[model samples]
Target: MNDNTSMGNGASQQNHLNGQWQGQPGQQGQGQYGQYGQPQGGYQQGPPQGGWQQAPQPKKKNWFLRHKILTAILALFLIGSIASASGGGSKGSDSASSSDNSSSDSAAKSDDKKSDEKKSEKKDEEKKDEGDKLPAVGTPVRDGKFEFTITKVERGKTTAGSNEFLQETAQGEYTYVYVTVKNIGDRAQMMSESDQKAFSSTGQQFSTDTSASLALDGDNDFFLTDINPGNQAKGILVFDAPKGTKLTQIELHDSFLSGGVKASL
Candidate 1:
């Protein structure tokens, strides 16, 4: 019985050693499977099955990339804003420049108008200055003569027996006077001899005679013969007055003699 018992104990020891060896192999296998297993809970939770893993799933998408897109949009917005500002500034500058130019033009026009007015005033002054340089008519001088009296002084006329001659006188004792003169002293003396002969054929004569039975208060006509030395002439006379009348001054002027002489009657 003792021998049998010892043999049984040795077998049991061998069996324990075998069980330990088997347990060690099983633990090693479990460690290897833990390091490289399929995903658990629907997610890959271990190291890669091949030599490398999927590069950490690329870190979801990445907020920086999204930020880049937003930044591009912002940049575009900035560009548009800058362009609009520049355009507005240019337009305003152009408008201001145009206004300034117009103002300058208006000022220039005003200056021209002022200059024209001044010129007109200067011309008017010159014209006034030119008007102060002429001569005026003067009164006359007289002298005595061989009993000269203006019988009839009137515009000249040519008619039978009165070709530029004094034809009528009053019924009084008087001396007639006829004077001929010119304005510029440039015309020839008297009518030609032929003209005088023709006038005489018409019973016309140039005379300064007085008659007792003559009719005055009518036209006294005469022809211009010559211009006096000073382009002037005078006719003076004396007449038989009504008993106690006094002699007076005489004045003479034009010939044929419309506007001839004035006697203080």
Candidate 2:
């Protein structure tokens, strides 16, 4: 009886241990789904068919490659800044200098224009002073101390005479040039017959005849005579110009100091 009891207890203990292990999981690693539908620690398990896949990690980018254009621009800007600082680019300064030069040129041009204008004005004044009188015939010319007018001119006379003087024959044909004169000075002015002159077209100059001029006309004769202030004298001046000489112009003078007046014949 004792032997039978020991064998039965031993068999029951072995079966209990086997049942405990088989109830939890199979010992061979639970076939394809290891630890299938089981909880590990405090977490529950998902379906075995759907396996978890790891997400890919992002790759790092090169700093220069990511912003190549911007990086290049920034690098160039840095280099230019350094270069300009060292070399003194002087862009703004150069502009200032150019403006100064341009202003100087403008001022110079203005000065030149003013000089030219002054020269032109001076020339005009000189012309006005020299050409103050009309150059036409039959117009009276008033010089400093005298006013004179030409009335008529007769030529081709051989004998000239008057009651006061003996008749005289001209070496050449006589030319009678009639004129009127007025003394504009405050005092009496003497009219000189030698001061009268006539020019020929052949460039010959002839002076007035003293004797022939006195015998020219008794109505009015002017030669060596004192003309009172504001008084006038009319007379004919005879000249022995060369024969066949064409008269051109006549010049008259009031005194030795007079700048003579010229009138075209």
Candidate 3:
């Protein structure tokens, strides 16, 4: 009868522990052991379906990549700005070069025109110089104090001077040039035979033979004769030159120091 009573009390204590572990309503809590030999509230359970996991954190995107349209627009704008600046600079440089070339061309043209004008003026001066020629024979040329007119010329003579005592013989041949001299100045000028010169066809110069004037017959005042102003005198000039020498021109001067006037014979 005592053994039955002990069994009954033990069974009741077990039931009371199970009720506390199960967390029954209106039941006071107690530290209880589970069937797995662990504390009841501290027991660990397996994952429901898959392996163990944690809540995933979202990935962050690059700011430039996130706003693709804005980034692309900014890139395109930069590229276009660079191209425009480059094109504008090139055009400006071209314009400046063109301007410089134009200016240089204008300056060159101006210089060319000046050169052309100078050439034209030179040509005109040359033509004027050609026009101002010396007068021919019988055209009345004047020196400083006398006006002379060459009348005639004679060539090929062996001797001169009609006076046998003062007569002169030619070393070469003798030529005679007849001229009329008129003094136009206020004072009398002495006509000098030595101041006259004769040129041949080949430009050979011949001087007058003053001693041959003594051989001349009749009114020959060629020997250092002084003529008053407004008076005229006839003179003969005798030249000693080679045989067959043809005198083409005669230069007559009023005095030895005077610049002569040339007349074609």
Candidate 4:
């Protein structure tokens, strides 16, 4: 009886110590199985693989629908900008062209005015220099670069009475004048029958008659001739006029550019 009582007391004491270890409600305890391998206090848990979730996608934008007024304003602003650029370019081009044309026209008119002014001044000077430009026959006149003397006047005559080849009867009566031209200039002087004109008393002018020129003998005509410096040309010019017409004066020119000298018949 003593051996059994000692064994029973030792077993009871061990049992009491084991119960103390499992005691206390709502106390710290070992982890139970749950999602993410975290502790769950006596609750049912899903599988660890089901804890993984896809992130939410961002919502797609509806830009036109979200800001209707801002979209309309941007569209109108773009159209206005395009229209203004186009119209401004065209207007600028037209303005530039017109300015260029106006500048060209102004330059042209300025040049023309200068030319006309120069011409007017030149003509005025020429008029001021013209003297002894008009005179009568039988008068000795001094013109530019030359001196003229009307020596004789013979009317109603065709040609001189040479040995042969004389035109005695002409279509109209003939008049003759003896003239002498002296070149007082430094250069050679030219003479032309066209430069000599016979004026009737009635103021009618006649050119030299060439019909009887061939029949006449002698170098008395001054056509197509030149006189050197300090030299002279003595010539006879013939004309045809109405019968009994009075030869009043003669006009002579040394050159086409010479002012000319006149002499009374």
Sort order, lDDT high to low: 3, 2, 4, 1
Q: TM-scores across all candidates? A: 0.29, 0.47, 0.48, 0.45
- What lDDT would each prediction earn against the true structure? 0.39, 0.75, 0.81, 0.72
Query: 148-257 in candidate 4: lDDT tens per residue?
Result: 88888888874444545565455678887888888999999786766678776545788877645434557564766788999998887778788888676677787767
Which pairs clash inside model 4? 136-263, 136-264, 137-263, 137-264
Give the per-residue lDDT digits (tens) of candidate 1, residues 1-265.
9998999998988866654433234233223234354222234456666766446555566765769989888889999999999999999999999999999999999999999989877865653343222111122222221112333322222111233353443333343333332343344333111111000111222223232112232322222334333454333222333322222323443333233333321
Range of the 10 consecutive residues with the lowest summed lDDT in candidate 2: 23-32
Whole-structure CA lDDT of model 4: 0.72
Evaluated with lDDT, which candidate comes out highest? Answer: 3
Ranking by TM-score: 3, 2, 4, 1
Q: Please estimate how well model 3 matches the true structure, expressed as its whole-model Cα lDDT.
A: 0.81
Return whichever of 1 and 4 wins on lDDT. Answer: 4
Whole-structure CA lDDT of model 2: 0.75
Return whichever of 2 and 4 wins on lDDT: 2
What lDDT score goes with residue 10 in model 1? 89
> In candidate 1, what residue range of length 10 has the lowest lDDT sum?
192-201
